[model samples]
Target: MNDEKEPQANPWMKSLLIWVGILLALVLFVSMFDSSSRQPDGTSIAYSEFLARVDEGTVKSAEIAGNVVSGKLTNDQSFKTYAPSDPQLVDRLTAKGVEFRAKPEEQASFWMILVYQSLPFLLILGIAFFVMRQMQKNAGSGAMGFGKSRAKMLTEKQGRVTFDDVAGIDEAREELEEIVQFLKDPSRFARLGGKIPKGALLVGSPGTGKTLLARAIAGEANVPFFTISGSDFVEMFVGVGASRVRDMFEQAKKNAPCIVFIDEIDAVGRHRGAGLGNGNDEREQTLNQLLVEMDGFDANEGIIIVAATNRPDVLDPALLRPGRFDRQVIVPKPDIEGREKILAVHMKKTPLAPDVNARVIARGTPGFSGADLANLVNEAALLAARKGKRLVAMSEFEEAKDKVMMGAERRSMIMTEDEKKATAYHEAGHALVSLYIPGCDPLHKVTIIPRGRALGVTWNLPDRDRYSMTMKQMKARLSLCFGGRIAEQLIYGADELNTGASNDIQQATDMARSMVMEYGMSEKLGWLRYRDNQDEVFLGHSVSRAQNMSEETARLIDSEVRRLVEEGEARAREVLTDNLDELHRLAGALLEYETLSGDESKRVIKGESIGRDDAAGRRAAQMDTAGSSIPKSRRPGGGWDAAPQGA
Candidate 1:
């Protein structure tokens, strides 16, 4: 994805090349010492043979030093001999008509001489040459570049990402469209005395297409884009980050009307002293410079700053103020409609079977981000390829969604028959409850085939994206969640219950607690948030995550959560009891198939004439007429809001 020119490797490559050259020079030096041994017809001769050769005038030339002789013979062969302590050696050699000469008085190996006499100087020169070459090779990227802006400059033509390429988060796009218009024609807004916002901050969860949106803004405006990460500004050296920030802005000003996008800006924009380590970290200095640069520039300068981060809560207060980041665009998870568009964008080039429908795929994905959709498409394509299919099919998409949501099918996982049977019943319980429970999301699929850590998985996709749920819907969700556990209790009894419901219990408890403590649904807790969860602020609103409650109030909250879970369990128990025969039939179907579709579940629900208790029947009939608004008593740990009229 990073298409930057493979950074000037010449610098490091030059250093490596120098070391190689030095190694080669050392190898040559070693080879030069052995050069004499490579001569042709070289022979060893004793002193007597040397004397005879000299006497016969067959010795052409000879050199002697420290009683050792070396020379080429009359036959053009090279020879060497030792003449140890002959008092008349020189005189005798001269008298025998041999050309004789005395060798150097040092009498040491030439390589030794070179090493001892000149190695240090040569080594110093080589190191100096290496350093100089390294400096020249790394002319602009190390110390010099530490303070230089590392922003990747993309030209108008190179930036192919436009608003068309991005879907989902339509509101976010609308928010940035004005900036694009302003960039394209400043006079349109200036005529009305309107000033463009100095900065726009994109805050959202990860993989929500923050960076993609930023690029789309740049591409739409058709201006040079400078893209850099927040971490790029920070360096090991103090003040380097600040220097880079100033340099980056100066460059942006050079290319006027350009957009400056910083991804993951929280890296440098976090509140000071909030993190551990240095008191005046480079990150802090960089943030200060960024603040000054953003403020120093005029709103009419045609330069707009855009930053993306999920952790906006931890960002410095100054950075988020109106004058600094005038607009805070929230890029939330895509709704069903937006998800379909995003999928369409990613699937543009993909070959799909006739059965593939973007809307259907989108409906199955409730909370997927743009990145998730793209990944899902890719996963489906991969599955098609693995199965040797030429085109991706809806079945492949279904498999991919399951893989993305519940993890892989995990067919390799081995389980005992008893365990599989229990899992089947458990999953059957969930499917049946969801199928019959009004206001609950329709069941999608149920499988005893284990995936990830779950021994079985039951999937249900919501009818649509709901911003708020009715009380009836919440109650239905409660019963659906507890259906599995209640089924286990009914089939195996209390004595034979397994630990498989651990996750279900924890999730149900958390849901109940959130409803009571934060949602203020509990009558005793009233309409107040008993607990504050300290979290990042997005679009001018902060969801407090910090706890704010008395110990007694906390105890009451715990009791309320326990009461909700128990109530859900009791409701599930009653439903299962009324349809005990249907439960067995469904469990049998699940055991045989190991998987059941929603329609298959409905088929199992048909032909069931089980009768309900009088009170339950009256409540069910009343629920059909009521508007899903139920009133409860003022007491804590109490069951559902006031029961249906007849109950």
Candidate 2:
């Protein structure tokens, strides 16, 4: 059943075979019809018959063409014969009164002779031309582009972005100011017997101005900046990446005192040999070349390499060693004052009303980065424009902020009265629990409006950014997350509890599981964190099937997670039981207005104006003290700090 068709021959081969066949056929026909072969039936009276026919006047017509003579007999018989060099051949033909003609010797056509003579030379020349063109085309990109560096050079003319242009990362800027000084006055450091560090790395979460700080360094140093992505160092070709690495360093050497910045450096700088999967040979070669270049270059050469990546944990240790990226500057999310500064910087582009204070906006955006602030300002301006307002007012900014956090108001998403009441109660329950919990984030806003995939949203914005979280706050958050489901069970009974709190339960379950497995919060696990050692360099997830524990440990982990969730639910129930009247009041307010701000929520819950948040308690975070509720297993030397102690 082999139905495969045989492969066909090349068209040129087929055409050449046909031409050869035609030539052979012509040769065979010429051999078969050669004038030297006498016909089988013809009489062999060559010279005598020719003389007799010429004398008898039977040769009616004759022609002498070069060597062979052809004539027609009077009886209409044709024959071809050669003529000897007879001086009176023409006179003899005239005497016999026979019609005869002699053809002049034919000369070869000029163009035909030229073609036959030059064909070989023409073929050779055409082949050479085609081959040379193909070679040049390949050299242009197939070979040449592989060896050229892809870095873009930004000189003083293109980049004027100094440290002033960046905000919300003051610590990083200060950390890099020395590098700037080193680049500007290398001799000063040299005279002091201090060698400038060859490299610095910027690491942080996305949108935290990591790349911006690198540009700011180049601007402040007033040096040529070579900008490229870590990916630009890699190519599909085997040796191209290594060649590019050499090329880039050579260019940087030509422009001494320049700064080279590779943004998103994890693309080529992942840990070697044993992290996520088997290492890539091409990528490894490029990395090796980079290592060689870094070692070969002198620290006093005044060229600095600054790279940025969000995944510093996955970078190779060899890259971060001393004399390489010796300095690691952290660019974190903005704090209250930093957010305020960033907003003011972005607000300079837009006309704003006096009532729209940047500080107020900063207080509301605790974890916002400089980029987020810029986006927020843009959204506010867009809202103002949509309303044809001359200036972006406080109301517009507030609406935009609300829209950013909870998503755009879905007024068109119609709901029955019962569904509305259920959503209202659910949101109010979250706000109410957070209000009573001492370590919980301050309850900011609650709304029953549908946004994204949620039926309602409850915002709990901290007054400031936090670096860590404590066990007490985590447990409080777990209770706070499940408060909606608890509320539904309390008001509508277990049978009537809908799927609105399904997302809440799932979140609570995952948090509890993380506390047990990754955070070492379980007593039975005994400070043993069951987390994968694998790290993904490119932000993709990695799963390592390297569990060392037995099935019993897994079951215990599941049991512990369930206990945490149940305990949190019981706590929520107790809190709601004691303040049923307040919960009802909050739910009622939500039903009427469909939204409640921090002040309104506080008034509904505590019957008082919104006062200062628990900053005093927050600043005195007792991570190691007995006052902390985190399990000792979870708290390694001490507990995790839930907040920036004095920040």
Candidate 3:
């Protein structure tokens, strides 16, 4: 019965048709009334008398009919008559005057009225049809757009970043070049039965230009590049993530031999079966679909997936297997030369003064990444602007570099005069100790003025890159870390030790603990590493179990660490005591200059006759204590003879 019922007409059209019909009916009714109201003589007459005269021949010249009469009058004039046709109307007309006239040709016919009324309906139907058709078209377009991959495609002309635009990643670039060549000529390698890698994973810490490298690949290959974030896949709805993965792959396949780069893949590719609760189930599903698409039945399709993640360990192992990601590129922190190149790249657009040196800036920033270098340049330019300088000078960059690494200099930080003096002497002690320690890098600068949260800072610039460290180097560093507190105890008694040495103490303690527990540099422990448990936590849940260790061994590890720190502290006190007068002189110089370089501090320690290299050699020979569990032999015959001692 429901199917048998015909659909109702559209309300919008029905109302339009009804209004048109009413207008036509009103026009016809008005025309009929006009035809009945007037006489041929242009004068009103009683309707009954007029009808009587029309019916009788006394008014013989007028012919009478239903509501109409026409005749030739006695005066030879054409005439017409009008009256009510019914008997009831005739009775009413006997008391009322009425007149009539012939209807004009301009009055429309019934057929014409019907045609005029239906015109509007036809016009409305056409307009409604056009609107509905347009809406359907737009709806289809919108749906198609939703399934399209959000990856940005960049052609050669559109991509401004190329291999030349990238810096500080020479090895990564060389590896990526193979992909670029494959994109340029796929058949060359295909003819030799060599299949291009399906994917390459870029793993590194944040701000290391993983995204920038992907762009360079696209620009170099001159192919369509698709870039999207890992988070783009997972949506609130179930199956949405998988659907997006399918859509993304479909898009990449359509643009065959293209690169599809996903940044921060860990967002979707977290290790399955690790996360607690059902919240991550959708993400896991998305990751599963991605794995299938990467290495399933259609694995060798021309699409090359490039993904980047800082936390590669958290990614699904399936995704990183041989057939899936295929290759993993580690973009670690830049080294000295890499840093210099990165600094140079960022400095190109900066308005640097003639004396500004990229090498100096690179040397100052030790652990900075490519993004950090860019930010450093921008910060230097800002400082220059603040000073109203025409160009960024070397001094501005120096200040900016310090601001980036150590934080902004707080010259206005308030402290008591006694506190200030104590800080100055403490920093001077650190400088003095580092100066006399062999294998310790030369001091870059020592400033008693407060910077960031630090009451004072002693900057040590390494003479060269040292990938490996010996026991002498570690012990020397420990002594330097303890020197500040040692100086306070010696000059102003143990009561003078303030919170200023908190960071130094913590660092010294950590080093001591690592030496005893991890590095096995303790005499009694003898090559035993106590640290076995190292579990990483994600989202407040432990990803793995901790290793078990006995309480007795833990106590022994603690004792060894404490012994190392105490011995280092005693040595610091002894060194500071012997150099007390020189320490005072160095502190006084620092108070005057607000900063003392490594060379100036060394001059205060040994005078002009003792060159930096000679002083370093002497210090190395003096620190060779027997029975001390120094990890490596400290001999002056090696490259230690070449480095400047203090600076």
Instruction: Give me the candidate number with maximum lDDT.
Output: 1
**Model 1 per-residue lDDT at 376:** 99
Model 3: how far residue 278 lies from native, Å: 6.3
Predictions in order: lDDT: 0.78, 0.75, 0.72
Residue range 374-441, candidate 1, lDDT tens digits: 99999999999999999999999999998999888778988786677567667877877887778888
Residue 322 CA displacement from its true place in model 3, Å: 1.8
Off by over 4 Å in 2: 1-144, 156-159, 275-280, 297-300, 518-525, 532-547, 605-647
lDDT, residue 166, candidate 2: 89
TM-score of each: 0.80, 0.70, 0.71
Error of 2 at 394 (Å): 2.4
Q: So what's the TM-score on candidate 3?
A: 0.71
Candidate 2 per-residue C-alpha lDDT over 445-465 given as tens digits, one digit per residue, 9 for 90 to 100: 888878766778889888677
lDDT of 2: 0.75
Error of 3 at 433 (Å): 1.1
Q: Which stretches of candidate 1 lie over 4 Å from their true place?
A: 1-78, 82-144, 156-159, 235-237, 273-279, 297-300, 535-552, 607-647
Which of the two candidates, 1 or 2, achieves a greater TM-score against the reference?
A: 1
